[model samples]
Target: MSSSALPKPQMRDLLANCLRFHIVGAIIVSLEVAASYEFGVAEPRKKAYADSTKTMIPHKDFEERRKPGVFQSTK
Candidate 1:
C-alpha cells in the first residue's frame, strides 16, 4: 500500500508514535547517564561494554568469522 492512500489521522498517529518513542528513549538514556556518573564505576562499565559488544568485520552470512578482538585491555 502506498503512503498516499493512508488517511491524515493515520499519518498523524504514526508521527506521534515516533516522537513518543524518541522522547522516551532520550529520557531513559539521560537517566542512565546520570546514574552512571553518580555511581562512579564508569571504567568498569566501559571495560564490560568493550568485552561484550563485538565489532565484527564485514563477512558473508554463510561464513562465520566470529573472532574476539584482541585489543581490549580488560581481557
Candidate 2:
C-alpha cells in the first residue's frame, strides 16, 4: 500500500473546477444585483401614482353632500 494508490483528483483538475464554479457564482450575483436595481428604480414612479390617487379625494363638504347611490360616478 502507498499514498499514491489512493484515488484522488489531480490538483490542476480541482483548481479548474473551483475556478469555474466561482466564475458562475459571480455572474449569478451580478444578475441579481441588476434586477434589484431595476426594481428599486421603479419604486418612485409607483409612489407618485399612489400620492396622486390620495390627493384626488373630494373635500369634506363635497364628500358630505355626495349621493350614496351605487351608480355614482367620479367627475
Which candidate number has the best TM-score? 2
Residue-wise C-alpha lDDT for candidate 1, range 1-75, written one tens digit per residue: 766775556644788899999999999999999897867887778877887656544454223433354434433
The list of candidate 2 runs beyond 4 A from truth reads: 1-6, 42-75
The digit string of per-residue lDDT tens for model 2 on 1-75 reads 666776775867788899899999999999998888778877778888999888875675476656555336853
TM-score of each: 0.39, 0.43
Query: Candidate 1 — what's its lDDT?
Result: 0.69
